[model samples]
Target: MRGVVMYAPGDVRVEDVEEPTILAPTDAIIALSATCICGSDLWPYRGADDVDEPFHMGHEYVGIVEEIGDAVRTIEPGQFVVGSFFASDNTCEICRAGYQTSCVNREVLGTTGRAQAQRMRVPLADGTLVATPGIPSDDLVPSLLAASDVLGTGWFGAVAAEAGPGKTVAVVGDGAVGLMAILAAKEPGAERIIAMSRHGSRQRLAREFGATDVVEERGAAGVARIKELTGGLGAHSVVEAVGTQESTMQAIASTRPGGHVGYVGVLHGVELRGDDVFMTHVHLHGGPAPVRRFLPELIDLIWTRKINPGRVFDLELPIDRAAEGYRAMDERTAIKVLLRP
Candidate 1:
C-alpha cells in the first residue's frame, strides 16, 4: 500500500509501505474510502513540531470495513464506518463520562502508519468506530469524513465554551476548526458569533456559518473588538482554535470574567501564565477532542443534510498527491484538502 510519509520539514512523500493487519482482537482493518490532511499535520511539516524520524501522516478518515478481529462484533466487513483519531475502549470510566480521547486504553490512529493509505488498522473497533445506517452516497463522504476529526473538534470546543441561547460567542483563528466552531455555535443558538479572521475568503465562510461580526485585528486590538461588539462586557464564550501564544492570550482576553474558553488547537510551544488566568477567572478547558462522544449526533446531522461541514475541503487530491495537499494547506491556498484513495 502507498501512503504519506514526512521525512522532514517541507518534505512529504508518497511511498509504498507494508499493509496493515489486525494484531489485536479489538482491531479491525478498513480500506479507506476517503482521508484528508489536518492542520495539526502542518506542525511537523513546518518544523515547529519535531520529526526526529520519518513517520506516517494523516488521521481523519472514512472507509469500509474489510476485516474484523474476533472480539469486534458490532462492525463487519463491507460496513462503512467513521472513527475518531484516538481509538478508545469506550467502556472505560473516562470514556463513559464522555472523554474517550482520555480512555484508559487508547491508541492514536496513524501513529505507526496513518489512515492516508489504501487501507489501515483500527484498534478497539467496537468502541472507536461508528457505522452509517447504510452505505452512503459518494456526495456524503466528505462531510462524514469531517465528523472524524475537524468538525468533532470544533463541536467539542463550542460545547466546552457553553455556547447556547443568549450567549455571545467569539472564535479565535479562521482555520477549518475555527470555521466549524462557528457552525457548531450557531446550531446551539448562540445569540452572536464573532469570528476573528483577516482573510476575506475565510470571513465570508465565517459569516455563512453564522458569524455576526468579523474582526481582522489580533492581540489587544482583537480583544477590544470583541469587547466593543459585546458592549464592553466581552463574549460569554470564546473558542481558541489556534495553538499559539498570541492566539491563546487573545482568546483568554476576549472573554468576559467568569466566561468559558474552549481551546481545541494542538498546542505548539504555548505556555499560559497562571497568574493571568487566575486574575481573569475564566474557565479554561480543552485537549484532544473526544470526537467519539459526538460522532453519533454529527453523523445523523450529516446523513440528513442538515449541515455541510465538508465545504471546508476546498481542495481534493489523490492519495498519491498527498504532498501537494500538505503544501496547499501550509501555503493557505486551501482551507482543507480531501484525499481519495
Candidate 2:
C-alpha cells in the first residue's frame, strides 16, 4: 500500500505504507477510490503547526468497502461509500443531536492514521459511512468524495448561520469550503449571497455557485461593502470560512445585529475580545462540522447531480505527485487539489 506522509514542513512524500486491517468489530476497511488535500492540512505543511515527526496526511475520502468486521452490520463489502473525517458511533446522544463529531466514541481519522492511501480502516463503520444508491460511475467519484468533508462542512456552516429563504448571506474567504458555502446558500433559497473574495477565479466560481454579488475588500472595508449591499443593515447571516482573527471579526461585523455567524474555518491562532462581541448582538456558532449528520442527504444530492461541489478541484494529481499538489496550493496556483489513489 502507498500513502502520503509529511516528514517536515514543505516535505511531503508518497511511499509504501502498511496496509490497514480491522482492529475493532465495528470497523471496516475501504479501498479508497479518491482523496484530496484539505486547507487545514496546510497548517503543519507551512510550519504554522508543529510537525515534530512523520505525519500521515488526508481525511476526505470516498471508496468501496473491501471488508467489514463482525459487528459492522449496515456497511458491507462492495458498497461504495462516503465517510466523514470523524469516526463516530452515531448512536451516542451527541450524534443523535446532529453533532456526530462530538460523539461519545469518536476517532479523528487524520490524527489516528491516513485516508490518503489506497486503503484505510474506518472505525464505527455503520455510523460513519454512507453508501450511495449503487456503485457510481467514475465521473461522479470526485463529487462523491467532496461530500465526505468539504461539502458537508460548508453545508453545516450555512445551516449554523440559518441561511434560508429571505435571508441575505455573506461568505468570507474564497477557499474550497467558502465556495461550497456559496453553493449551500443557494440550495436553501437564500435571497442574496455575497461572496467576499479578492481572487478573480474564485469570484467567478462563487458566482456560478449562486453568489449574487462579489466583494473584493478586506477587514472593515469588506464589512462595509456587505453592509452597503444590504442597505446598511449588513447581511442576515455570514459564513466565515477562513480561520483568522481578521476574517472572524469581518464576519461578525458584516452581520445585522440579530443575524448569525457560522464559522467553519479550522482556527489557527484566533482570539476574541469580550468587549468587541458583547455589543454586536450577533449569534456565534460553529466548529468542526458534524459531517456525518449531513452525509446521507448530501450523498443523495450528489447522486442526483443537484450540485457539483467537486468543481472546486481545479487541479488533479496522482497520489505519488502529492508533493507537487501541496506546493501548488501553498503558492495559490490551485483552488483545491484532488488526489487519485
Candidate 3:
C-alpha cells in the first residue's frame, strides 16, 4: 500500500506502507476510491503549522467497504460509503446530542500521519460512514466524497451562521468550503448570498452556487460593500471559512449586529478580541464540522443530484503524484485537487 506522508514542510511523498486492518469488532477497512486534498492540509505544507516529521496527510475521502469487523452490521463489504473525517461511536452522549465531532470516542483520521494509504481502517463504522442508496454511477464519486467533509463543513457553517429565509448571508473565503457555504445558504432559503471573493473562478462559482453579490475587496472595504448591499445593515449571517485574524475580522465586520458568524477554518495562530465581538453583539460559533450528523441528509442530496459539488475539483492526479496536487493547491493553480488511488 502507498500512502501520502509529509516528512516536513514542502516535503510530501507517496510511499509503500503496511495496509490497515480492522482492529476492533466495530471497525471497518475501506478501499479508497477517491480522496482529495483540503486547504487545511496546506497550513503545515506551507510551514504555517508545526507538524512533526512524518505524518499521514489528507482527511476527505470516499470509497468501498472492503471488509467489516464482526460488530459492524449496518455496513457490509462491497458497499459504497462516504465517511466523515472524524470517527464517532454514534452512541455516546455527545453523539446523541448531535455533536458527533466531540464524541468521547471520536478520532480524527490522517492526523496520525498514517492516513491516505491504499486502504485504511475506519472506527465506529456504523456511526461514522453513510452508504449511498446503492453503487453510485462513476460520475457521482467526487460529489459523494465532498459530502464526507467540504459539503458537510459548509453545511455546518451555514447552519451555524443562522442562514435562512430573508436573511442576508456573507461568506468570508473563496475556497471549496466557502463556495459550498453559498450553496448551503440557498438550501435554507437565504434571500441574499454575498460571497467575499477575489478569484474570478471562485467568484463565478459563488454566483452559480447562490451568491447574490461578490465583493472583491478585503478587510474594511469588503465589509463596507456588504453593508452597502444590505441597505446599511451588514449580512444577518456570515460564514468564515478562512482561519486567520484577517478572515475572522472580515466575518465579524461584514455581519450585522446580533447576527451569527460560523467559523470552521482550522484556526492558525488567529485570535479574536473578546471585547470587539462582545461590543458588536454578534453570536460567534464554529469548530470542526459535526460531519457525522449531516452524513445521511447530504448523502441523499448527492445521490439525488439536487446539487453537484464535483465542479470544485479543477485538477486530478494519481495518488503517487500527491505532492504535485498539494503544490498546485498551494500555488493557487487549482481550486481543489482530486486524487485517484
TM-scores for candidates 1 onward, in order: 0.98, 0.99, 0.97
lDDT of 1 by residue, 1-341 (tens): 99888999999999997799899999999999999999988888898878999898878889999999999989999999999999999998999999999999999763343888899999999999999999999999999999999999999999999999999999999999999999999997999999999999999999998999999999999999999999998899999999999999999999999999999998778898898889998999999999999999999999999999998899999999998899999999999999998
Encode model 3's per-residue lDDT on 237-279: one tens digit a residue. Answer: 9999999889999899888889999999877788777888788
Q: Indicate which candidate wins on lDDT.
A: 1
RMSD list, candidates in order: 1.0, 0.8, 1.2
lDDT of 2 at 289: 94
Range of the 10 consecutive residues with the lowest summed lDDT in candidate 2:
108-117
Those runs of model 1 whose alpha carbons end farther than 4 Å from true positions after fitting are: 110-113
lDDT of 2 at 146: 87
lDDT of each: 0.93, 0.92, 0.88
Q: Supply the global lDDT for candidate 1.
A: 0.93
lDDT of 2 by residue, 7-102 (tens): 999999999989998899999999999999998888888999899989788899999999999999999899999999998999989999999998
